[model samples]
Target: MPAWSSEMGAAMQVQIDKIFKEAAMQENIDDDAVFQEGDGVLAHLKFSFTLSDPGLKDCPLIGCSDGFSELTGYTMEEIIGRNCRFLVDPVPQEHVENSARMVAREFCIAVKDGEMYTVPDAHREPWMPIVHRDDGIFCIQTNARKDACLFKNLFHLKKIELDEKVYIVGLQTEMPIELWDEDQPEEKRQDACRAACRACHKNMGAAEQVMAKHFWFSSPMRRQEDGNDEDDGFV
Candidate 1:
């Protein structure tokens, strides 16, 4: 019997809660946001759905949350048509392959639109699997605030259908150090966020990989990468 991520019912609920909470903390939302998922996270969930064009190379952001706006200091009109990764300043820690680490960093810092969004080349280790079912790409990525200050974000990317059109959604929250005094040193915040990223990632493995509520396509899902549009399926 093959398993799928859709079977993760209770876990889904927890993911939703965690996602909302993560977003709430970053922009300094009220405590009420802790339970209700903040103000703009849900409304701002749908991101760049431009995956329709095999010709278009980059994934653009269609919308974002108010908390996101607060955290990055970007207005809706300004960010509506840019690659989400433009905000990224990746801090590489999980290195399966040198290529994977480089790709992650390049996608975040170097590559232009559509360039970094592709899956790893067939010859390399597929370290960055886009876990479709569970919570998408749950990682601790550093993004530059509008003020040019670097901040850590609990980033998430998921693909969904809307009006028969497919779009990739992005959600981000500034995770805070739990139980640690705000007066604590900056290093502690890094430790807390790193731990949070690890725990979130750990939950997505195991049985959940079988369920793979992640994605399904009739003709294998292929994406355009660096050179000729070659791919080994899902990103």
Candidate 2:
């Protein structure tokens, strides 16, 4: 190869830099964890709280993230003050799809309705650690976006007490499609559906499933370990 002038080498380097910069920006658009925090939490992955409003009989959106708008194709103004249930698809919970699930759904509904549930005493299972789960809710539900596109939401509700105020924060993370794979082992699939929220809490890495693509308009999700990354209602 012939030796190149310093100017020629510099020109090539500039072009290479430009290409890399473009690629990085594209990846930022594709990945969800656009921002990271000093505390190691993904800012866009987790957002605001909701109160269990008795009079309204609904959990309204008290706050949210910009990532949610981008993913769902909705503007912040549209969702802010509305009930989060507006996005619930109803299909997954209603159409359990089999006899086993039909029975399970009844039990799940019961548990939801303040029945057949008791707090397990600490040390009952050495493998399981005791945690205050009374106020937190863990559920897997299908949700729809602005245009009626569907995706599974690993919905987690957290309880926070600040003096006299209690905040029930709704933390949503999109789940991977791998959970629905037909080739997945039967035992694994069954356990996913049958066990308590802990099954997915462990397997899917709770609060860390933010590595979701725009599932509706995109290819299969390549989630948190794969890469990584929310919102509210209006006036």
Candidate 3:
């Protein structure tokens, strides 16, 4: 092979140094420790906000990431210090089960906005939908099986603004089941769940690679409008 010139060699060395520096910086970042292994799994982003008391009027966005901006079409400047409820749309009462509504009311009792909600331990049930306390809207759904749990929790709520109209984003994550054993320990079950989550993220990355070539090449004008395209539509 031909040797690189001194100038080109120096530039290449600088680029390598920059890559290492960035990798080190990312290692130091504390957010989303669960997905920080950096084995090619997509990093999951989480947002938290503070809700007001009694009237619950001033629900300000406290934290977010660039991933959220890509998902929601709103920059941190536009979203931070603003009520997250702006992204929440009211759910129809007819669709919500009475039991879920009751659970939501109980979950919201004296709950502050910035506080994180713990997903309940419902290992016996196949599916359980968790509703947001303030809006009574379905925010998350959980499943008893490990793979099912990953599929349900992976892609979360995001609101997209298109043509000056706000629309709730939809994305589903699907993973094929390899085995179903009912006798696994709780810790073992959780490990399986994390593996499943990683698998789904990897699968999404693979699909994007294919779409970037075949689908996008076929229609150069039609780009993925938002982050929801990352999901496989299983949910």
Superposed on all Cα atoms, model 2 deviates from the true structure by an RMSD in Å of: 17.8
Whole-model Cα lDDT of every candidate shown, in order: 0.40, 0.38, 0.33
Deviation (Å) of 34 in candidate 1? 13
Best by lDDT: 1
lDDT of 2: 0.38
- The CA lDDT at 121 in model 2 is 44
Model 1 clash tally, residue pairs? 12
List the candidates ranked by TM-score, beginning with the highest: 2, 1, 3
**Runs with alpha carbons beyond 4 Å of true place in candidate 1:** 1-57, 89-135, 177-235
Residue lDDT tens for model 1, 1-235: 1121222322433444454345435544232232234342232331111111112355455444344556677765566567665665342333123443344444433222333244345523222334433234444455676776665456544343333344444444565424235676655454444444333344333212212232332212211112243321212
Across 1-235, the per-residue lDDT of candidate 3 in tens digits comes to: 1222333323323332333334435554343343454542333222211111222345344334333343344555665555443433233334233443333333343233333344355421222233343222233322222111221222323222223322222222222222234664554434434543333332333223322332233333234534344433211
TM for candidate 2 is: 0.43
* Alpha-carbon shift of residue 110 in model 3 (angstroms): 3.4
lDDT of 2 by residue, 24-92 (tens): 344432222222233212222322212222123344444344545554556656765566556663445
Q: Against the correct fold, how does model 1 do in TM-score?
A: 0.41
